[model samples]
Target chain A: MSGSSPGSIERLLGEREIVIACGPGGVGKTTTAAAAAAIAASRLGGDVLVLTVDPARRLADALGLKGLGNQVTPVPPEVFQAAGETPLGTLSAAMLDTKQSWDALIGEHAPDEATRDRILHNPLYQNITERFIQSHDYIAMERLYELHSSGSWDLIVVDTPPTRNALDFLDAPARLADFFSSRLLRWLIAPSRSTLLGIASKPFTQVADRILGTQFLADITEFFVSLQSMYDGFVERANAVSRLLADERTSFMVVSTSETVPLREAEFFATELATRGLDIGAVVLNKVLPTSLSDPDALAATRRLAQRTPEMTAALAARLDVDASVLDRVLETVTESFEDFAVVARREASSRERFPLGGATLLTVPQLDRDVHDMEGLLTLGSYLLGS
Target chain B: MIPLAERSLIFVTGKGGVGKTSVAAGLAQMLAFQGRSVLGCEVDAKGDLAAAFEAPPSGFTPVSAGENLSLMAMDTEASLREYLKLNLKIPIIGRIGPLARAFDFVATAAPGVKEILTVGKLCYEVRERHYDTVVVDASATGHIVGQLAAPQAINELVKVGLIRSQTDWMLDILSDPRQCGLVIVTTPEEMPVAETVELAAKVAEETTVELAAVVVNRVLPERFSPRAEAVFDRLSSHEGIDALSEVLGADSASVVGAAALATTMRRSRVQHMNTLRAGLPAGTPLVLVPYLFQRADGHRATRQLALHLAEEIDR
Candidate 1:
C-alpha cells in the first residue's frame, strides 16, 4: 500500500454525510464518486449510496444498476464477493434519469392529478424536461435533496451532470426558483395578476409576437399557465435543495485529470465553490502519469540506450534470445517511447505543481493500464483512493 | 459523403476535454493553410478556440488569426441583435433592452429558441459564402443535438413568424452533405468512443446534419512490432534488466516501464478503436491524430494536428 495516504479524503468520506463530485467532463468524476462511496461503505461500515449519471456499462452491471432509473438498487454482496472482497455495509447506486425525475417532481408538486396530467402531456413540457440542458442539473440536485431527506443512508455521494459551464449545476436550483417566481413568468401565466408588470411587458410581447408568432406564444402561455399550479411547491423545494447543498454536512470534491485544461477548470470550479461558501473537501487528480517517468536517472538511461551501439545491441539480443538487428530496433523504439511519455509526464508534473489547491486536500491516482469497468476494478481504484 | 474539408461548414464537437475546439481550429487552420479563406467560430465562447490559434480572445466581430484564418466567438445576444436589424429592420436596437428580456424569458421557457440563434448565425455565414469553409467549435456532444435540431424544432413550434421563415434555408444547407457537415472528435478511450458511437447514431436519427467524418484524436501509437514485443517481454525480466543496467550504468526499469506503459495503453485503446470502427456507418471516414507527448496547447500542437489531418484527408 502507498504509505502517503490522502488522509483528508479518507476523513472526508468518513465524516461528511454528503460528498458531491463535480468538475469538467471526461475526467473520471463519476468513477471517483463511486470509488469513494464503495470504499467508505466497506471501510466505515455504513450504508452508502452513489448517485451517478451514465456510468460505463460494465460498471453499471457491477453496481447492479444496469438499467437504472429513479429507484436505488443495492449492489449485492455476492457481486463484491466475486470481486474477492466482503462488504462491510450496503452500497447502492442509482443513475440520474432526468425525464423520470421531472415527471415525479410534477406529480409531487402539482395542485391535482388533472393539472399534473395536463402539464405532463404538454409537448413543451416534455421538451423542457427532456432537452433543457439546465433541467438535468436542477433535477439531479432535487433528487439528491429527496434522497438526503429520506434518512435511509448514512452517506450519499452524488455525481453532478457534465454541464456546459462547470458552475451551471451549482446555480441551477437558485435559477429554477428565480424563474418560477419571477414577475415575467407570473405575467405570462396571467397578465391580470399584475397590471404594472403586465403593462411593462406589453410592447415586449408585441415584438415577441411578431417574431415568435401568436400560435407559439399561445402554446407557450398555455404551458406556463398549466405550470402555475405548481409554482409555490417548486419555489419552496428548489430553495430547499439549494440550501441543502450549502449545509454543513455536505462537502464538494472537485475531480480532474492532471492535464492542463481539466486541471485549470477544476481549479476554477474549486475557487467558485469556495466563493459560494461551499466547502471543498478535496481535489482528486485521476490518471496521472508515474513520477518515475520524469526521474533524472531514467531519462539519462533512456538517452544512453537510444544510441544502441553494436556491442550493447548484440549483448541485449543474446540475453533476450532475439536477433541483434531486431534488438537494436526494439531498443530504439523503447528509448523513443520513453522519451515521448517522459515529456508528457513532466508536463503533468508541472501542471500539478501550478494547481491552486488552497486549503483542499490533494489526491493523485496514477494512470491504470486498463479501463476500470468492473467491481474489482472499482475496488482496486478504491484502495488507491483510500491508500489502504 | 462529402470529404470533410470540402464542406462549406463543419461543426466540430465531442465530449468535453476531448479536444473538440482544437480539432475545429486545426481543421480551419488546415483550410487556411491551403489558401482558402476560413472562419472559425467558437459556439460557447470558451476562449479555448482562441488559445488553439494562440490569438487574442474572439468576439462577435471576427479576429484575424493569421493569413487566411479569422476566428469569432458566438454571442447569442449579438446574433439576436443582428437578426433584428437585418430581418426586422429594427432601428431602435439599442433601446430594445426590455424586449430582449422578454426574449430571454421565452428562450428559457422554450428550449430551442436560444439554440436557433447559435445555429442560425453559423448558417448565415455559410449562406453568405463569406468564407470558403466555416468551422464551428460547437457545443459538447450532450447539447449539440439540441443545437443541430433547433431549426426543425422551431419549424414545428412556430406556425408563422420571422423565425418560422428562417428555418427552411438553414435546413437546406444543413441537410445537404456537400454544404454542411459535423465532425465528431474523440480520443480512443471508453467514455469518449462510446459517446462518439452513440452520438453518430443520434445524429443520423435526430438531426439532418451530415456526418462528414470522425476524427480520432490522441490515438496512442504502437511502437513495437510483434517480434519486437516478444523480445521486450523477455527483456523485461529481472535478469535482462540487470544486464541492461550494467550496460547503461543506471536503472533501466522506468525506461522499460515506459515501453510497457505504451504497449498496454495502445493495446487497451485498440479495443476502443475497433469498437468505433465497428459502430460507425459502413463508410464513415476515420481520421487518426497521434498522441502529442509535447504539451497539446497553443498554435504548435494545433498545426501538428492540422498536418496530420491533411495527410489523412488526402489518403
Candidate 2:
C-alpha cells in the first residue's frame, strides 16, 4: 500500500475485514470504493462485496445491477473477469434499501399483530423510517456485520453518503441506542412516570382531549400511539446494533479530495471517530491534481504564445477575415489577454501538486478525464488505484 | 424596459456557504430601511437565510423579521405539490396528497432536486414580482450549476407544459444579464479561492449573467509591523535574551501566536485579494469584509454586515 504510486490508491484487502469510503458529494467515493473492491477480487482472487448507501443508485448502475435492494446481487463472472488482469474472484454488491430494512426490523420486533400493523401502516413512521433519524443506518451496519461474520467475502467495501452527514450513518446505531435508552422514550410511552404528566392527573386518559385543534400535532400523536407497543423491542435491537459497531474489526476510512472543504471534513470526521473510540485506518484523497506537467516545454510554449498575442492577433486579422470584425475583435482580445491566460494556466498547473496534510498516510488519485458510469470505467479506476 | 424601481427581483447567489444569506439579509435590511419593499429568499433547504434574519424557519409564506425584510423558506414540498397539480395535471383529491407527498419525497430524494426546487421557487418569485428583491441564498458552485441547469433538465424531461414554459422563463431570467447577475462569495482559503476561479469560468460558460462582484468575507486584520518582527527576533537572540526573557517570558506564547496569526493574516489577505483580482474580470469590484470576532448569526451582526455591504456597494 505504501509503495502505491502518486496516481493510485492501493488496498491490502486480504488483511482488512471492513473498508469504509467517505467524502463530500461528487468526490468519486462510490467509484473509488467500487474500483478497490474490483481490484481486490480481480487481482488477489479474494471474494469481495461492495455496499453503497448512496440513494442516487450510481453504484448500482456502475455495477450493472438491474434493481439493487437489501439482498446481495453477485456480479456476473464475465464482468469480474473483464475488470481484472488476472482470473477474477467472486464479486457481490448491494444497494441498501433503508426503508425496507426499517420495515423488516419492525416486523421482527413487534410484540403483537395489532402493534406491527399500527407501526407499519403509519405515514409519519414510514416517512421517518426513510429519514436520517430511523434505524436505517443501524440496519445497514447490522447487514454489514452479518455479511462480514458469514465469511462469504474476503473483503467488504462500503461506500457511504457524500455529505458531512455520512458520519451519521456510522454513528446511527449508537445514536438510536441512546434515543431508546433515554428518559424521553419512557415519558412518551408511560406518561405516568413523567414529572410534568404527574402534575396533570389523568394525563394518559386526557391525551386526546388536551390538544385536538392542531391537526399536524394530532397526526403526530396518532402515529406515535400506534408505534408504542414495538418501542421496547426497537430499543433492544438498537442496543445490539451499537454493540456490533463497537467491534474492533471494523475500520473507518476518511475519503476526501485534495480540496479544503472535503479535507477539512475528513479532519473533522477523524476527530469525531477518535472521540467515538473508532479506529481510522487510512485517509484516501480522491481526484488529486498531479504535481508535474505532462509536457513542461509545451506549457512554457503556450505561456510564450499567450504573451505574443498582439502579433498573433494581427496575423490572424490580416489572413483570416478583413470584414469579420467580430473575429478580428476576438483575435485582438486574445492577444491582449495572453498574460491573464498564462496566470490561469499556471494556477491549473499548481493545483495538481500534492496538498500535504500531516499525520495521515494519504493516498491520492489523479482527476479522471471521464466520468465513471460503467464497469469498464471502474476497471480502469481499479488499475489506476493499484498502479498509483 | 422596466424601470429600476419596477425591476423588483434581486437574486443574490455565489459559491455555496459563503455567507450569501448574510449578504442578502443585510441588503434586504438596507433596502427595507430605505422604505423599499424587500424579501429575502432561502432557496437552499439549509434555511441559512432565515437564520441570518433571526427568523423562525418558515416556508413559502413570507414572515416579517423586520420593518423592511421578510424571510421565506421556499417550501420545496409546497412548490412540488403546486407544480404537480398545475403542471402534471394531478387531481386535487385527498388521495392526491399522498401522491404529492410521494413526489415531494422523490424530489427531495433525487440527487440535486432540492437545488431545482430552490431555483424554481426563486424564478417564480422573480417572475411574479412578489417583492422588490428576491435575494436567493443559492447552493454553492457545483450545486448552483445543477440549479441553473435544472430548467434545461426539466425542459428536456417534461416535453411541453406550464413546467416547461416556467422553466423556459426562468432560464431567460437567469441567462439575461440585465435581469439577473451572479455574485460570487469566497474566503481567503486556497480551496475556496481555487473553487471561485473554477466556478466563475463554469458560470460564464453556462449563462450570460454578468459576474457582479466577488465578496471576500472574514478577512483577518493586518497586525504585523515591519519593526515588530525585527524587535521580536532581537529579543529572542542571546544578547537581548536575559532582559527580554524577564520582560516577555509569560507573553512568549502570545507573541509567537500573534506572529503566526500575523503570518496567516498576511497570507489570507494576499491570497484573497489576489484571487479576487485574478478570478474576477478586470474592473469587477472586490468587496473585502473584515472578520468579526463573533459569529454572523444575530440581528446586530447582520446589521453590521448590512452596513459593510452598503459601504462596499457604494464604493
Candidate 3:
C-alpha cells in the first residue's frame, strides 16, 4: 500500500530535468504541469518551459495570456509579480503547432531542397501531415527532443496530449519505424524494369495498378520514393526520441483525481510507464475530498452535534421567543451538509485506496471552492504541491 | 427526437473521465431493450464497455454480450487485416501470420489508414445489414473530430481507387443524418461543458454527423427551496449567528461550519449547471443523469443511465 502521508512534489521538481504529466482528460493535467513549471522557475531558481498541445487551450487562459503558438514566449514578469511571487529564473511556455513542427522536422532532415519541396508539396504528404492519426503524437516527441537538445531550459514540463494518445507518444519511435520498414512501401517504390527485383514484382505491380488506378499508384510511388533519401534521418530521429524519453533525468508523473475512473486511468498509466522501463516519479491526486472531516473523533463530534440540533434550536427559540420551525429547518440543513461531506470524504478515501502506485510517491491536492484561472491560483496550487 | 433505430451507427464521445463509456453502454442496452439488434463497439478501447455490460471480453469478431447486443473491440491491426481481406479478396495473405504482420505494420504507419479501417468496418456492418444499430464508443472529444474527418480527407488525396470507393461509402454513411449521428456526453462543469459546445460546432463544421443529444452526467440534485434558502441566509447572518450562539453555546461553531459548507456545495452545483446550459447550443436536447452518490459500479451505473435514457427517448 502507498503511504498515507503526501510526498513532496518540490523535491522531485528540483531533482528531475524533464517531467511529463500524463493522465485522462478533464483531470487538470495541463494546469498541474504548468503550475509545476512555474513553481520550479520562481521558487527553485531555474529556467522552465511548459509545453502543451491541448486543444482546449485552458493552459493559455490560466496563464493569463491571450494565446500561445509554436514559438516559446516568455511569461511576462508582471504576471508572476501580480501573484505575489518574483521569479528568480525565467518561465516560458509554448503550445505545439502540429503541422508546423512536422514541416520543420522534414525541412531539417530532407536530403536536399528538391526532396524537401517534393515531400512538402506532395498532395499525399500534405494529407498525411494534416490527417495522419499519429502525426500529433510523433510531432510532440519531435518538438520535445528539439527543445531538450537546445539546452536552454534548466527544467521542462510537458503537458502530454490527453489519455491513450499520450501513451502513443511513448511508442511513437517504434511505430514510426514499423511504418517505414514495411515491405508495402518497398513494393510501391520499386524502380520500373531496371533490375531482377523489379521483374519479380511485375505481377504484384499489375494487380496493384488495376485495383488502385495507375494514377493512384503513380502518386503513391512518387510520395514514397521522394522520401527515400530522408528515411534514414526519420528512423535515427525516432531512436533518439525513444532514448531521450528513457533517460534517467526524465520523469513521468500521472495526474488524476480521486474519482473511480480517473484512479483507474492513473493505475493504467503507471503500469504502462513501468512496463516501458521509464521512471515513475509521483502521482498527483487532485481534488481529493477534504480529509479534515474524515477523522473518527471529528465524525463523532459532528454526529452528536446533528443529534442535538433540534434541542439546541428549541432552546434558542424559547430564549429569543422566535419561530422554532425556522431554527429547526436551518439546523437540519446545516447537519445534512456536514453529513454529505462526510459521505463524500469516505467515498473518496475508498476510491483512493484502489489506486496501485504502492512504491511510487503520492501527492494529494484538495479541491478548492473556486475554479483556478489566474497566476494566484497556480501559485496557491504550487504551495500545496510543494508543501510550502 | 432523433430516432435511434433509424440510424445505422451512433458515435458516443466526450472529454475523458466524463462517463462516455457508460453512456454508450446504457444507450446500447436501451436500444437492445427496444427489440433492436445492437452491436456495441469500441476502437482502441480497453474492454470497458464489455465489463460494463458484464459480457465476455471482445475480440475482433462481434460476440453476444447481452440480449440483442453484440460487442467487438476494433484495433488498427485487426481492422487492417479485415479491410485487406474484404477489399483485395486475398485469404492466403490474411492467413499467413508473417504476411498478416507485415500488412499490419504497413497499415499502422500510414496515417488515417487505421481510422479509415475502423470506421470502414463499422460502415461495412451497416452496409451488410448485419445489425440494426452499431454504437461506437468513439475516441475522446479532442481527437474524435479528426477521426471522423479522416476518411474524407484521405478521399481527397486518393481520387480514383478502391480506397477512394471505400472511403466514399464511409462518408456516405456518416453524412446521411438518418444513417448516422453522434451523442455527446458531458458533466455539469465548466471545462467539459465548454469542450462539449466547441465539439458540437466542430462536428457540424467538419462532418455531416448530426448531434443526436447532449447527455449531462453527474448532475447534482437541487436540495434547497427558496424558503429554505432565505432561512439559511438569515441563519448565516452575523446578528443571527450571535443570537443562536447565545442559546446553543459551544455547538454554534459546528453548526455554522456545516452551514457554510452546505451553502458552498449548493451554490457551486447551481453555478455549474447554469454554466453548462448556457455554454451549450440553444435548443439542443439535454438528458440529465443524476450524480450517483454511492460508489460507482460499472454494470449497475450503466443500467441506471440506460433507464434514464430510455425515459428521455420515450418522452
lDDT for each residue of candidate 3 in B167-192, tens digit (9 for 90 to 100): 87788889888899898999876678
Pairwise lDDT winner, candidates 1 and 2: 1
How many collisions between residues are there in candidate 2?
6
Q: Which ranking of candidates, highest lDDT first?
A: 1, 3, 2
Q: Which window of 10 residues has the lowest lDDT sum in candidate 2 chain A? A: A204-213
| Candidate 1 local lDDT, A116-223, one digit each (tens) | 999899878888998878999999999999999999999999999988898998899999889988888876677734442353357767777778887777667778
Off by over 4 Å in 3: A1-3, A55-58, A62-68, A163-165, A181-214, A301-313, A316-343, B1-6, B80-88, B93-95, B233-276
TM-score of each: 0.97, 0.54, 0.90
Query: If both were scored by DockQ, which would come out higher, candidate 2 or candidate 3?
Result: 3
List of chain B TM-scores, one per candidate? 0.98, 0.82, 0.87
Interface RMSD of each: 1.3, 22.0, 4.0
Whichever of 1 and 3 has more lDDT, that candidate is: 1
lDDT of each candidate versus the true structure: 0.87, 0.59, 0.76
